[model samples]
Target: MFFVDTVEVPGLGNRSYLAGGRTAAVVIDPPRDIDRVIAAAAQRGVRISHVVETHVHNDYVSGGHELARITGAAYVVPAAAPVSYERLAVTDGDVLPVDAGIALRAVATPGHTPHHTAYVLEEGGEAVAVFTGGSLLIGTVGRPDLVEPRLTAALARAQHASAHRLAAELPDRTAVLPTHGFGSLCAAGAVPTDASGEPTTIGEQAAVNEALVKDVDTFVADLLAGLDDIPAYYAHMGPLNSGGATPVDLTPPAVADADEIAARLAAGEWVVDLRSRVAFAAGHVAGSYNIEAGEGPGGQLALLLAWLIPWGKPVTLLAESPEQLAKAQRELVRVGIDRPAAAATGTPEEWVRDGERPATLARAVFADLVELPASAILLDVRRATERASAGYVEGSRHIPLHELRSRIREIPLGVPVWVHCAGGLRASLAASLLASAGHEVVAIDDSFDNAPFVNTPAADRC
Candidate 1:
């Protein structure tokens, strides 16, 4: 048997496979790009017989249905799935025959999603590996709140029972292969730790991982607290992954020239600039979102959307170069923003002037805060998702940077506004948006220290 793990860091997800003697293979949690899965199977002279989904994911689009459509492999899921799809569904105690001596057993593990399941691969009745999707991670368990609250509670309970079942029923030697690992928000807390920093043993996880089989009450409490606010786009992306709809072509559409990109931008299209923050800081088109893809993954897309465009607006692409725009489009799809407006065909300098917000805005806001009235609102326009994960300055009204345009009426124009994001990137963007709308705004640099905002000392009065 041969096993391969494909990590799609671009999509912030993972997929794995089990190849038996180069003739047949079973893929688990295939990424949105199914070509790679096919390519891997072909390399080993194997054909994919089954495409397995441990659970319906909410983070990125799933390729299971598409893979099955292309390869004619059976799309397998838990029998209890409420959603409809063209495939075979199995439940606990059910075993899928892969070969004369090899089989995959479906074990219902419903914490992340109600119908979530895991596969225990057995060879000659010996358990070799168990594919735990969101149910179990290296250092954590799936967050129960990914679904309805009532269902989440039930799944949490089911997760506790299912984890114990795996710990007791499977052999200690069974290799634990999960769909996600460190750095994924799907998990609960710190990643699983081993001496070598590689995947750890189930035995090690059971002993140290708090979510493995702890008491139900403690398990539920810990799971809920760490549940960070999901990105605004997830509401639109999850259903599309359940095979409900097709994603629009994200490839930058062919345009006549820079005017076309500008026309799209003028029509309120999302323009994502995938330049370095330093480059963007030096100059970028007005109203264009700066992802600074140069910044490492994880929060690249989130930072781009939360800061550049307000929530609930369509997306368009604007990058430093054509290659950068193409790269940014793929990242956008992962977060559910498809068919980004036609990208700027020419250089960044061709579309707009490179001037930045007057340094006076920051200097003015800081000076005003020292003697500002209590009624002067110090608004932190960062997304709720960003603010919760990394604590925010106390008492700041969080009208996400993107929503500032729509909700500007909510704020009294006379009150001073100071906005910010994780770093100063989005804050600067937010400041620009507020300023254009005739609001007195300043962008503050993120300071994670647990201190009150420098000027508004009384604002901290809870």
Candidate 2:
């Protein structure tokens, strides 16, 4: 008998798999935190015999090396990948037997990267599931533009061919498990989710996935045109994965006093407050950025930091408790934002002991925007696709959160700016950025769904 379990790294928007026979199992595309995988295997009473990498991921750090080392598993990787580490390099058509009735067959499926492979798990001589990684996603293939600009067009074409190949070779009933399409930026476009918001199968996707139905040239053009700004941290992930990255250190960061934190902030280092948005808006250290450790939609620390913060900048973390600081550190390390320069945990009262007043921002809801004075500015910081699908408040200035830094000067100074995104997370971050730039800002820390003008015009009046 064979069984498979999916271990979701919700913060990173990727899923790793543990599949095995009764006695042994294989782990695929694990995140940097390996403890979860180990625990999952322990529960199943199976020794992990192999660890597989579908590709050298560009979005998050890989835990394959560390997982394999700890479990005494064969670290399996693509034969074409350039790495100095010891691993069992696999090629297309290579098959590894996991146990008496189960085996994983390698299928070369390159597109998201120059060297990518998908593993088909067969039980009792029948195909059961294919771990498609970034190649063949739930509703769309992985974006081909993460590599060099010159290779994007060619890789997109390759992506289309690879998708067709998988569809042709695999039976319709084969379960399609992918790593990139579930709210990750690695995909070319947004994929629809099931009731549980998890990805569906190859059979279901073939009927609905637009990429599968479009011509190769059209698909390639559309994929490239739809690409958004790559996160600055992505450039660091590829190299780190190719060479092995050290196992993440989840130890609590050393506590720093207010004086040290102030000095660091004065030095232009990021002093992030990982508290609730409500707590942050009420009071926080002057010059601190509010990311809110485990709040908002999924509250992915790595994704938000990578997308917003400039690369290689030193970061200091401030949280409400030692546990909060430790949790934030674990999430940040998965995306290679390891080892914050300093950390401190305390209430705003404790932090403001030096006769310094903590900064606060005005919080508002969508209803307040209706009676806004003409002098006040309403800035929508959601992505273009979000604005298009769910209409924005009319007359609001549109600038995505990722582009806010470069375009901050466009908003006039001395104006009260009200900032909002699909949810309150980006809005809080944007409000902090705007405030740092000397604008009077109000962050709308509420769900956009509750906003009356999402799908209708404003004149209709909630």
The candidate that achieves the highest lDDT relative to the unseen native structure: 2
Q: In model 2, what are the clashing residue pairs, if there are any? A: none
lDDT of each: 0.65, 0.86
What tens digits encode model 1's per-residue C-alpha lDDT throughout 1-462? 545455444335344554444467788887665666788888877778888888777766777777888888988977777556677888887888776577788987877788889888888888878889887777567777777766777777777777777888887777777776545556666563222234555687688666775797898777766566555555555677666435336556554245665566678666666665455546556656455553233445643463335545766656657776766666565555566545564555676533423123442333344555577677776656556555556676788866766787887776677765655666666665665556775556544342355223344546
* lDDT of the structure predicted as candidate 2: 0.86
Which stretches of candidate 2 lie above 4 Å from their native place?
193-199, 295-297, 449-462
- Residue 151 lDDT, candidate 2, scale 0-100: 92
lDDT of 2 at 344: 86
Q: Whose TM-score is greatest here?
A: 2
What's the distance in Å from true for residue 20, model 1? 4.7
Question: After best superposition, candidate 1 residue 149: deviation in angstroms?
Answer: 2.8
RMSD of 2: 2.8
lDDT of 2 by residue, 1-462 (tens): 899998877676788999998999999999898998999999999999999999999999999999999889999999998787999999999999998899999999989988899999999878889999999887789988887889989999989988888888988889898977667888888864332554466777778775688998888888887787687789889999999889888887777788888888889889898898899999998788888786223676778887778888899898999988887887888888889988989887676648888899889988887767789998999888677767887678899988999999999999999999977988998999899888999999888887765555344458
